[model samples]
Target: MSAEASVAAANFVTAARSFVGVPWRHLGRARTGLDCIGLVLLAAREAGVDLPDPAPYAREPQGTRLLEGILGHARRVAEAAPGDVLLFRLGLYGGHVGIASVHPAWGVPACLHAYAPRRQVVEQPMDDELRAALLGVFRLPALET
Candidate 1:
């Protein structure tokens, strides 16, 4: 990463970590509750990146729609670094999104997201299953030089 990108990643990761315990809620965009995209949106704002709301989405948006939303604001990338957006396939229900980060406990690559199943925001290691599901990696334009 470039020096500017590294600084932006650090700021973004710090903002994302602040939402670790927020409860999950459909279309939520606040500290009390947030969905995956909401978590990304708010964290970007806190990191000084102003992202427009990507709303009018279902609780389980189709894969194409999710990809479209991501593409609208970010460019697909080959590798994931901290602060990059990670897209994953969630079976037939479509997809999921998260902020890439280093796991606090394991000190390995992890994802910070508002997981519906977990019913809260969490930072979990990107284990094999998650790696298998990963569809793409993306980075916000503002975070790059």
Candidate 2:
């Protein structure tokens, strides 16, 4: 990677890892306050990843499967790296997105998420459950160049 990309790659993991242990909340984004989407956007912005801010719910269509929406708009999962975009389904109906960041503390496993229910961005096990639910994992489109 180029020096600039390398620096961002490092920051992506470091910035997101800093949010671990934050509690979960709807529409929240800080250690004390952050929902899933907020966490994702926060980490990405903090890490210098370029992405659109969360749009209003009414302006966007519901019932759009996360996998469909993500793959349709973002890069593919195969090219994803630390600080890439992550898309996944929530408990039942909610589809969420976050920065595909890493967690050095967790044996350096590949993870990317801001879990509000648990508060903060956390690194999760890249296990079967994730494999089954993940719609897509993608890096920034600009980075691809």
Best by TM-score: 1
User: Evaluated with lDDT, which candidate comes out highest?
Assistant: 1
Worst 10 residues of 1 by lDDT: 62-71
Write candidate 1's Cα lDDT for 1-145 as tens digits. Answer: 7898899988998999999999999989899899988998899899998877768687766655755655577888998999999988877743688999999888999999999999999999999988998988999897787
Name model 1 segments beyond 4 Å from true.
Answer: none
60-104: candidate 2 lDDT, tens digit per residue: 236544234333455665645676766666655436666654445
- What is the TM-score of candidate 1? 0.92
The 0-to-1 C-alpha lDDT of every candidate, in the order given, reads 0.87, 0.60
lDDT of 2: 0.60
Query: Distance from true position, residue 54, model 2, in Å?
Result: 2.0
